[model samples]
Target: MVRDQREIPVRDRLLLAGVQLLEKAGGGDVSTRAVCDLAGVQAPTLYHHFGSKEGLLDAVVSHGFRQFLAARRDQASASADPIEEIRQGWDIHVEFGLQHPASYAHIYGRVERGKRCGVVAEVEAMLLQALAPAARQGRLAVTPADAAAEVLAASSGVILTLITQPEDAVDPGLSTRVRDAILDSITTGSTSPVSSGGEVTTASAAIALASTLEDAPTVLNDAETALLRDWLGRIASPASSGARI
Candidate 1:
């Protein structure tokens, strides 16, 4: 049943109006007057609910991001190979960008000087969560945090590039190619030729041990565990050669 618009909360109505106008505008300029009219509220009501039109738009973008994250979490498979999960995550990220170009642009394409999008940290955290499993299995060449950063940077770049290209000119294989290259650079799987000898590097061992420590109980106390992590970090660091500068 189509309930009376009056029954809806003013805040929700404003958000719905803002998102509709934003999609209609192709993520371009949207005037407060138009949004207020669409929401059946006066200018002051919008301000009361959202502070300003810009604030409303930020809320819309945030809402879209939350929905995406929830859906991704629901669909994610826990038992899948970690590397494969990362690959699927990359594909999903790209697909979301393509399907919601305007919203995606707001998240990653539009940039302000020295300002970071709030959603980026959450995205990176998700990547870190996915990489933890690989780290535990000695499949990661770098720490989970490092790998997450690399993947986020590369994937965001790919999404922006794809979104700007003309529909006919978009490269079908670009996403997959870039995804594989970045994955290969950061991961050392048992099936990978470089890992054929079943030998683990000092850094890889340190990474795996550090990751596994989180899954099981340890005899060390908080301070000792912290010190141990510090030592492992030093071992895993590429520049930790004990050289005095």
Candidate 2:
């Protein structure tokens, strides 16, 4: 059936503006008038495009998820190894969170609870599909769906911590550390040998190494530093065995 495309651009602009405002002022500050003003459209036009403020927010969330999923899918498609694909997907997710913190948060953050947007289900399905090959190849220890869910959820926490916490408060290698910890947790028998000095565990060392990668530096802006430290503080203390390294 033929469909009407009358307000596509207007709707897109409103959604984009909503995302920007939501990031700057938060979800509660998002209103039809605000989004309309940001988009340079009138309130009536916004209503014409989106039935209500909630509808506009939903569209914004869905659009953000679509873009995020597409970027990850593209990155995975470019790589042949399933493990590398998964790693790249995580990297893309982190990049997205860092670059578009508001949009990413809108999709996965606390605001998503009552909204119940369908994007989460869609993204989850895509993630599960991506991990299927690894599970089938015995590269990942858990079921494909379970592994995907765990990795996705853990990555979300890592990204949120990185964005929300202050940089100086966290170890310089926080992101790398979290990534390695997650990787090790998901892959059975993939643990690295422990260090003798014990100044840091194997997982921590791996995180340090990962952070030093030419691309992933240890440097952080003031805000990032604060966020990092806060995130580190929130992590549970090491067990008597001291974190599986």
Candidate 3:
């Protein structure tokens, strides 16, 4: 049974209105008047709640995107393989984009120079969390932060490509191929004891040590840990040690 929209809170009603309008418009621009009319609230109410139309849209997109991720994260079973977890994350992101192109575009497509939405950081944080175990296991070829950046770049690019193409023309395997290529570049399959070349590079050693120390408790105090991290940073620097890849 469909509950009455009147029962919903004012703010949520506006959000739902905005989302509905965006979907109905096929990701096109949604007018503030339409949103307010759909929500059955005055224009002043929207401004009072969200400051402006863009603010309302941003809130809707952010809330919906985060909620989807949280639900999926909770539903997923724990996996011993962090790499597999990252792969699953990639799939979830692509699935969200394909299923909700309008919402996905609202998050990714609208960009201003030198400005990034908080949702971008949220996405990166999710990937970073997935990468932490891989880093701790010394499977990451670069720092976890770098790995997350690469993964986000590739995943977003693939999603945008797929979303923009005609549905019938979209390549089914594009996302998988790109994801594998990016992951292969940023990760390795061995512990810090030995990489593919049979010797652990200094950068890999520093990354593994830093990852391990960052997550687990240590004998050193906070300041000492900071200093150790600084040293590790220097060790991992491409200038000090040749570039990782």
What stretches of model 1 exceed 4 Å from their correct place?
31-34, 41-55, 66-79, 192-199, 240-245
**Residue 144 lDDT (model 1):** 92
* Candidate 1 structure quality by residue, lDDT tens digits, 76-194: 76645778889988888887778888877667556889977766777888889888888877777788999999999998889889889998899979999999999988876454322
In model 3, which runs have C-alpha deviations exceeding 4 angstroms?
1-4, 70-77, 191-199, 238-245
Report residue 14 deviation for candidate 2 (angstroms): 2.6
What are the per-residue Cα lDDT tens digits for candidate 3 across 126-162?
A: 8888888777666777888989999998998999999
Model 3 lDDT at residue 101:
91
- How many pairs collide in each candidate, listed in order? 0, 14, 0
lDDT by residue (1-245, candidate 2, tens digit) is: 65343445776778778888877864244667778787888888877887777678767777776777676666555765666677777777777777777666666565534665555566677777676554434344444555678877787787788877776674436666776777666554432222223234333433333223323545687677667644433332233113543
Clashing pairs in 3: none
Q: RMSD in angstroms, all models?
A: 4.3, 15.0, 3.3
Which pairs in model 1 have colliding backbones?
A: none
